[model samples]
Target: MTFRSFIARTRVLLGATALVLAGLPTAASADVVFQSVANPTDVTKFTSPWCSSCSNQYRIFDQFTLGSASSVTGFSVALYSLAPYWGSGLNFSIWTANGNVPGTELFSQSLGNADFTTTTLTGTALMATTDKVSGLNLDAGTYYVSFYNTNLAVWGYTGGGGNLLQQGNTYHTGTSADFILTNNVPEPASIALVGLALVGLGVARRRKA
Candidate 1:
């Protein structure tokens, strides 16, 4: 085939490929949006009731920021329970930031066996539980999150983490503990696919010449 005809066919092929790629949605992936490490000085407390009639119930809150719009897929938290209670129930709440504190409540729900998976450290009672959430969309801004076990032991947290201004008790602290928030992020490789297509076209054109 003549070089001109070969180039024309290549352009058409590239155009079709570009259109297909553009129409495809970005694949979602797990991303850690925020992670608070364990602090030694912070007070730890039992944030939830062990039973339905239990009067000793508590809650805890932590702060995090998002640089861009994101959808939360799930979260993982550290627990200091006597034994591993995988697939146990837990509660979560999200709120707008109010000057270093939680303001208006945005989302709250109870997660059950269907929503969670658990892992326990070897030779230790330390357990970490991850729960799947029905995507919570939020704009770029600061926010606060609070959570507790529905019927389990204490939540590992840093009561105020040496920040005296933070209010509340160990059962209901103004600060948070060791935890991580996961977001559904678009894959960066999607952009590279376009570049790869262009490179392939260039390679073919050189061969024809």
Candidate 2:
């Protein structure tokens, strides 16, 4: 092919790849994306290893906004246990953010009562998908997901000894870092749009050729 023809073909291929990727579901697209999340260092960086004697609640902060109003169905918790959830019997309280800093609690639920299970190969942490938590409508604004009520360890980053959460009449710090979690579903409509985008890409390529 001539140099000009080769350049055109390369552009088409790159455009096609970009279109395909744009359709894929990503954390920012359809998942519970965290804000100011701590980086994972090691398995031993588990925060809140034990809340048995603790009478306070600790919650991390996340600021998420949507292009349009949508309902958040559920989330997944990052834990650091060597055994199954039932083996250690872990539970947590789910909350929806309201104000700023430590935000006001809008919704509440027992994480144990909801569906929970390990998602990865090691089976260290648990993930409860949709149908676990009820629906909560979200719009173009900031929000936070907070949890407490168990002694389970969480894969967190850089909040262990610094006050990251507050409960009762006191502000508490992390044992190591902040808890890592996200509870949201990629809406079926969004998934369908992605598929359509990919298909359209094929048509566009054929037309370009």
Candidate 3:
């Protein structure tokens, strides 16, 4: 191939490489923490802040049900707090629901003072954290998630006020904390394989030309 043609093909290969790299999954993410054996029934992802009428030691309560068997590795949440609330530590936990409210405690975990980090969200300031990993496995039923032990964060909503259903599915409970759970370690997305195919196609087209 002439030098100009060779350069053009090289650029195509590099561009395709960039796209694939961008789409590849991270080594780990609290976002895609685990794979589910069965879909979570009445699934909803929750996040809360003390938007109004919240007090010290406020408790968050949310519930979800699994269709089959699953093991939850950890949880993560969007935490909102002001300067006054920053402190030495924060606590979180999972529990069973009684009449769709916080009930018997099942598992609990704690965070160091510095673990919480902040970012701007929707023109609001908030602190969010990575998956606080745990060793809780749940069955084909319902359970509640709660975030407590902080004087600094907002309550987002009270008693199921701001929980959102996963786009098309109904939420399992009326109210809960903002958190995501993982059943196993995170996995790569199928898009990476698609990227490889695209790269192959681009190389083939260049050769034919």
TM-score of each: 0.54, 0.45, 0.52
- Using TM-score, give the best candidate's number: 1
Worst window of 10 by summed lDDT in candidate 3: 35-44
Write candidate 3's Cα lDDT for 1-209 as tens digits: 88578768778876876676777775554434322212221222323444221444245455566666676665545555455454545666667767635568888878776665544343333445545456766666766665656454533323443342221223434444444565445446455556667767767786788
Model 1 RMSD vs true structure: 8.5
Count the clashes in each prediction: 0, 11, 13
* lDDT, model 3: 0.52
- In angstroms, the error of model 3 at 20 is 15
Whole-model lDDT for model 2 versus the true structure? 0.47
TM-score, prediction 2: 0.45
Tens digit of lDDT per residue, candidate 1, span 59-178?
556677778887777887655444343336667778888886668999987787566665653332344455367758888998877665534443444443311112244323443455
Alpha-carbon deviation at 87 in model 3, angstroms = 4.4
lDDT (Cα, tens digit) per residue for candidate 2, span 106-168: 666565533665554244544333245565555655555554544544454344322334344
Winner on lDDT between 2 and 3 is: 3
